[model samples]
Target chain A: MSQALLFYFFAAVAVLSALGVVFHPRPARALLCLVVTMFALAVHFTLLGAYFVAMAHLIVYAGAVLVLFLFVIMLQGAGAREIALHQRFNIIYLLPAGLVSILLAGGLIALIRGSAFQALKSVDGTAENIGTLLFSQYLLPFEWTSLLILLGVFAAIALAKKDAA
Target chain B: MIPATHYLILSVTLFSIGILGVLIRRNILLILLSIELMLNAANLNLIAGSAMHGRLDGQLSAFFVMVVAAAEVTIGLAIAVLLFRQKNSVDTHEIKELKG
Candidate 1:
């Protein structure tokens, strides 16, 4: 019962903050809202017994990725005048988007409800187990991810560097 | 124990909101954030499945998803920065070179 309650609370937080990320007018505030959403998701991960994943999510998402977003926003300075001029909400666009999202959620929920899930057992999501699995069964993909990260670093540097005239 | 159906429902809700954000927001940063939101929803589904099945495969997959998400954000933000440098604006509608 308590697990259900905890799940509901965090689930509500995740959904609401996610909405904030969408509807908040200011970009910085929207990013903060996304951070809250990430925190709630980390909690959900913990509740689901994926402890290592929960920690990694916090570090990778809230720690690194969001800071990158903040740096970019700070560097550009999303000015108020620009926001007021271009960020006005349009009901025509919103209406269709809302309809589509509602349709998608309804369809997915209906499908989920139709299926029967077996009883759940809490998995061991310890760091040691994940490390072993990463090194053994998933070693190739794991190494490939390191290469992907290197590529991403080079790409970011290349794209953001100013060209000399 | 919470039912898997509930987790699935929550994931669906989050994913839908992400889609809505992507479609309605004109700002490029918000669009990228929405994509992150969608990715998180998928990660939630994977973790829940991992727990339900009493295995670590789903968690490993979620880890990979996170790595990919990180790389995606890096590339995406770099593109956003470049766009701002060229156009002095991060609004999506400003870029229409491919509208033909």
Candidate 2:
């Protein structure tokens, strides 16, 4: 019962906020809504027993990313101006979006039907098990991924610099 | 009343909205935010699966997903800012003036 209630609540919030992200005219309001959405998602992660990841998600996305987005929006001073409507490619865009969604939905449905998707009972996705697997089996990927992130950061700075010049 | 499918469906619904936002919304910043929403939906699925399977793999994957999402948002926002400076608008539509 508790799990069900949490699922519905988070799901509703996620849906609503995602809509807000698209429909909200003001960039600041949209970004703030995204932050609230991220916080709710983090709470959902906690309820699912991924306490560590949940906290990390909150810190990185809501704390860091949202702040950065807000900073950019403020620095740019893009508010009070109307966003241009690029409706020319709407039809073309819908084709890809619909196709992608259908394909993914189909694949997920197939996988669920062919596999066991029953609700797990207290599997305890604790930080310890995550650390163990991440370092042992997924160690290479994890470390390399971090390197990629660093490179990505440098790339962003490079791009920013190029833009500035 | 909520079954595993309930969570799955909800996640998919949110994911679709995020996807819709990315495709239809013309603002680069809003598109990036939508992408974040989509990533969170995937994280939701990961955790929900972990909850159901009694395993830690889902959470582990979710952890990795979170990391990737952070990196992606950083890069994306940087590009968006650059675009903003060049075009004077974050709207993706007015960017037709890009020179090869």
Candidate 3:
């Protein structure tokens, strides 16, 4: 019963905030809603027994990413977006795009249908287990992903510089 | 009593909404926010599958995914700023100068 309730709560938060993020007209409100969604997803990660992932989500996304977004929106000023949105709202490009999205979703569900289910055991999805696996089985990819993140940071900085002039 | 398919379906539905946001919304900020939604949906599926499969690989990939999402948004926002500087508006509709 507890598990079911937890699932319902997280799912509701995730789904609702997700919609709010997309549907909110104001840029700041939309960014804030997405932040709430990311935070709730962190809780869902905790419920799934991945404590490290939960904490990482909170720290990286809620702490860093959303803060960056909020700062950017505030710095750019909300009045500009409001003025533009008031002038024109064209959604004619969305119909075909939405259909393509629906088709992609159907494809994902069909792919999952073909996969075999393996029952879980021991439920040891903790930080210790993650650390163990990281050092033993996934050491190479661990370093590689770190390199990828560094490259991403550099690329972002470079992009900003290239257009600054 | 939870089925794995439930998580998958929820992720798919959220992904679809994100796509709609990207495709439908005219604001660049909204488009970027939609991208975040899509990435979160992917992360949820990853963690859920990690729990079900008795492995940490999915969770690790999810960590990387979050990192990349943050990085992508930063660069995207920066570009949006540059565009705003040039064009004075963030509307995807009216900012189409290179449409070919």
Q: Give the best candidate by lDDT.
A: 1
Q: Across all candidates, what is each one's fraction of true contacts kept?
A: 0.80, 0.72, 0.58
Clashing pairs in 2: A119-B52, A120-B52
* Winner of 2 and 3 under TM-score: 3
- Which scores higher on DockQ, 1 or 3? 1
B55, model 2: CA deviation in Å? 1.5
Give me the displacement of residue A64 in model 1, in angstroms: 0.6
Clashing pairs for predicted structure model 1, backbone only: none
TM-score of chain B of each: 0.98, 0.92, 0.95
lDDT of 1 at A3: 82
Regions of model 2 farther than 4 Å from truth? A80-116, A163-165, B97-100
Model 1 spans with C-alpha error above 4 angstroms: A79-82, A90-92
Segments in model 3 whose C-alpha atoms lie over 4 Å from true places = A79-89, A108-122, A163-165
lDDT of 2: 0.78
Candidate 3 chain A: worst-modelled 10 consecutive residues by lDDT? A79-88
lDDT of 3 by residue, B4-34 (tens): 7777777887888788888777778778878
Instruction: Considering the two chains of model 2, state its CAPRI-style docking category.
Output: medium
**Top model by TM-score, which number?**
1
Output DockQ, candidate 3. 0.60
